[model samples]
Target: MVYRGPYRVRVEEKPDPRIEHPNDAVVRVARAAICGSDLHLYHGMMPDTRVGHTFGHEFIGVVEEVGSSVQNLQVGDKVMVPFNIFCGSCFFCARGLFSNCHNVNPNATAVGAIYGYSHTTGGYDGGQAEMVRVPFADVGPSVIPDWLDDEDALLMTDALATAYFGAQLAEIREGDTVAVLGAGPIGLYAARSAWLMGAGRVVVIDQLPERLEKARTFAHAETINYNEVPDVVLEMKLQTDGLGFDAVIDAVGAEADGNLVQHLTSARFKLQGGSPIALNWAIDGARKGGVISVMGAYGPMFSAVKFGDALNKGLTLRMNQCPVKRQWPRLLEHIQNGYFKPSDIVTHRIPLEHIAEAYHLFSSKLDGCIKPVIIPDAS
Candidate 1:
């Protein structure tokens, strides 16, 4: 799938990607996913989303070729390439902050490079196509364990890792009540992960019944339909005994539903940062001394968040573009122990040739789509 501007995507033939750097590896994509964050580019909410640029970050593939400097992987190895493109020797990377590496994106002083995002995020092409080039191959692309399923590996590439990171940021303690806003893949993962992190009670909030049902079945959490409730924040407050949840995870980034004005202004009209509805809800619904972990992908522009309330509430707000490689070993242990199924949320499978229709289905939330993975026809 190629971006031809907002709301316009098409399948086009492109040159097979090849290694360009000494530490790069070219992978033949096997499975790819349409992440919730990708919609920001689909709607032109993010800057520098260029025409003909592939828009996928969650992918797993077989390494077709490895650069001479690649030490850990070789050709024929099945690997999962992380979304963050960073040099291992960078200052941030030395400190385990790979997402904020200073050596990757020349356009920014903070954020590191990302695959398939616009120029604002470093212009590396994404892995939506049959072939993708992975940089810093030795440090970024890890061999997929033979026991791990391809779909799970694809989920780990972004959704699962980000969710786990969000939970880690929340610092959920035993007996803590956690509220996860958004029934999307990341939200589901966060809810599930919170349980593994010792959250005593978990609640998932969303408007979609299918998604809420998924939350119940997949995440095993209490569900709340935001549309049916008289007041979402009030309901959350009431559920937490009028105090608020101990921790809240905002998985719905810019395109969250609720306020039509905020949605239109940020998502549709591009007048402000993406909608802060979930983040604000998180802030308003967390207890006086709580944690708000933001795993949602927001645009660079400003959003109308409640900072003063957060300050008054003494909330520890933790957020970042999840460093995918950081959470692998733990996720592997959980999956091996059968704690969670990363692919439980996959509702649709589409061939890469039909990716535009797949994108439409996912973006429109049609046919109960939760997570859609693309199987490239190469293999």
Candidate 2:
């Protein structure tokens, strides 16, 4: 797929990738996902998103070729590639903070390298194609156990890891009440994982009926239709007995709805910055001294946040790009122990050829699409 322009993606043929460095590996992509973050690039909200770029950060594939320096992996190994690309020897990576690695992206001081995100994240071509070039192969790609389902492996590449990381950032205690904003894949996962982290009560708020239904059914969370409620913050406050939730998460990122003017300025006109409606709501909805975990994608520009309120309330704000490889051990155990099926959220399976249509359906929220995965060989 090639990004022709904003909202102009189409299937296009590109050259098969080759190893450019000794630490690089070429993988034959088996499955790739269109992440919510990709929509930011698709809509042209992210800067330096070139017209010919391919946008995808969640993918699982089989190793087709390995460079001389590749140590742990070999040909024919099935692997899940993380969204963040990092050099193992970097200062941040030395501290296990792989997402903040200072060596990969040209603009590393601003934003670390990420696959298929945009030029801001290192303009590496993504995995929404027949093959992809993976740098720092020994440290980034993790081999999937034979028992793990391919679709499950696909989700762990980004969505599941991100959700788990968000929950971890919240630092939920026993019997805590957690409120998650948005019912998208990550939101649903965060809501469900909150229960795993000992959240006694979980409430999910969203406008989409299907996603809210998913929150109720899949995450076992109390549903809040933000569209139906007069004041979502008031509703959340009422749910928590006028205090607010124990921990609130903002999974709805730059494109969140509710404020028409902010939407028009940030989302529509590309002025000001990304909308902080959900983040603001998370701030306002949390109880005093509650933790707020943000896993949403925001562009480099500034978004107006309720810093004064957060400061006054003494809320802990924790957020970062998920260190996907770091979460693998726990997530693997969770998957193996039947905590929750990561792939259960997949609502649509699409062929790579029809991704444009799939993107349309997903972006428009048509036909109950919760999560969509692209199969390279699907006909």
Candidate 3:
């Protein structure tokens, strides 16, 4: 897949990746996913998203080759690569902050390298193709458990992991009422994960009827169509007896609905980094001193946000590019226990050749595409 420009992506022939360094390996992609974050690149939201760039951060594959120094993996090993490209021994990685690895990205002070993202990350090609080069092979790629479904393993590379991380950041206590903004993939997973973390009630907010229904069925959470409610924040307060939710998760980033002015200024004009509507809603919809967990992707630009309101409310804000590998062990256990099934949310599986159509369907939010998996070889 090659990025032409905003809303322009197509399948293109590209050179198969090779081991460029002693620490690198090459993997034949078995499964790849179109993440909500990928839409940021598809829509020209991220800075330096170059033309001819492949746009995938969630993929699992079989190790096709390995460099001289790559010892942990061998050819034919099935692996699920974490979206974060990090060297395990870096200062941040030493503290288990793999997303901030200092050794991978030259812009390490900001965030670690990521596959198939723009030059703002590490400029590494992504795994949306038939093959991808795996850097720091021993650190980021985990061999997929034999029992794990391929579709499930693909989601763990980013979506499920990030959602699980978001829920963890919320610090949900037993019986706490949690509100999730957006009924997208991450929001859905965060809602389900909240239950595993002992949240008493989870409410998902979205304007789309299909997504709202998905929130109720897949996440097992109460649904609130913002379109139906006169005021979303007030409705949240009313649901929680006027005190507001104990915690809130802003799972909609950049492309959030509800506020036309913010959407136009941020998403349309590129005047701001990304929409802050969801973040602001999370702030106003939570109780005093309630925690806000943000898992949404935003560009590194100015976004008009309610900082003063957040500070005055004494809110605890936590966010990061998810350290995907860090959450796998617990998530794997959750999967084994049948508490979560990541594949349940997968609504479409389009081949790489039809990726343009996939992007169009997802971008338009048509055909109930909550999540779409990309099949590289299906064409």
Candidate 4:
């Protein structure tokens, strides 16, 4: 099924995904998820998205077939697919950076193509169907433990992986104070990851009281409602004894409260005539040597800044798309050991037919819809 237009859903039969390479395997998608990235495709923001191109990436499925030369996996294995498809032997993969594999894309691009994305990717179909063909199966997919439910493992591909990457980039340590901006699914996962990484105090900031409350209940992290308390960074500093936090994860990105200060500083040169209040607040909120990890998706161009101030403060800023392959193993182990539960982020479960409704609830943040997992075949 491909998204033909806004709020449109059409089912079309596609060629059965088959094993085309020695390292390939065919997966029968048992469960798939709709991510914020998919919302871009839904809104027609991603160019060159044709009809019948398929439109989902996050999934957990069972292997129905494997190519002859495949190793370390076989038919009947259940697995979680990584969003970024990559060949395991590329230069980037050799450096433990599988997101930038050269061969998987082979389009003169450094990074591999994502499943069901625009032409920037290889136009490979997505997993939101009965079956999906996966390349580099041994390196790109992880077998799920028998005890894990398919829904719980679905996030290993994107959300959980992204949170794990944010945690890594934040360099969270035992007893360090951390603040996560935004209480969306990704922000919730970021908080959970920080807790797993041993942050002494993790505070999730958001305008929605429902989301903040859920974060407190689910992740055992503290919450500060940005709506009620206007000066969030000030409150954070007060809670942290005027030193600000050790790490801050900007999960909200450009959509943050008027492009928060950190974003303004990062993209200062890009901002034209928008309010700079949030930008100022974010800059003042960080401790001298604190780290900021940005994982939000934004438009192509924007501007604002104080590069000299950031440089002088010696703050470490790390930003990038979530490199799914590099973080899946640790996340899987976390799931296996019961240290993290990605399923907690899901607030709604609806059949594929109600996807538009789910999208409404998700986009409007209604009924506390944090992450709604869509079951394609469920009636």
Taken over the whole model, the C-alpha lDDT of each candidate is: 0.88, 0.88, 0.88, 0.75
Off by over 4 Å in 2: 256-273, 300-303
The residue-by-residue lDDT of candidate 3 on 80-164, one tens digit each, is 9999999999789999999999888875478889999998898899988889999999889999989999999999999999999
Local accuracy of candidate 2 as per-residue lDDT tens digits, 1-379: 8899866899988888999999999999999998877877777778899988988899999999999999999999999999989998888899888888899998659568999988888999998888999999999999999999999998998999999999999999999999998889999999999999999999999888989999999999999998788899999999898999999988877753324345446554211227777888999999999999999988643556789999999999999999888999999999999997999999999999998997887877789988999998875
Residue-level lDDT tens digits of model 1 in 1-379:
7899877888998988887888999999999999988988888778788898998999999999988888899899999888999898878999889899998899889689999998888988898899999988989989888899989889998999999999999999999999998899999999999999999999999888999999999999999998887889999999988999999998887863224345456544311236676788899899999999988888754556789999999999999999889899999999999997899899999999989999889988999999999999834
Higher-ranked by lDDT: 3 or 4: 3
- What is candidate 1's CA lDDT for residue 4? 94
TM-score for each of the candidates? 0.95, 0.96, 0.96, 0.85
Any runs in candidate 1 off by more than 4 Å, and if so which?
A: 256-273, 300-303
RMSD score of candidate 4 (Å): 4.3
- Candidate 4: tens digits of C-alpha lDDT, residues 1-379: 6666644556666789887988899998888887766765665445576766787788878899998888978899999988888887878778877667778765537447788776667788888777899988888888887787787789888888888798889988799998887787888888988988889999888778888888898878898886667567679889888988898887765442223343334444221112233333445567889888776555322344455666787888887777787786677788889888788778788776666676666655688777888787784
Lowest lDDT block of 10, candidate 2: 264-273
Alpha carbon deviation, residue 109, candidate 4 (Å): 3.6
Better of 2 and 4 by lDDT: 2
Which pairs clash in the backbone of model 2?
none
Residue 353 alpha-carbon offset, candidate 2, angstroms:
0.9
> In model 4, what lDDT does residue 64 have?
95
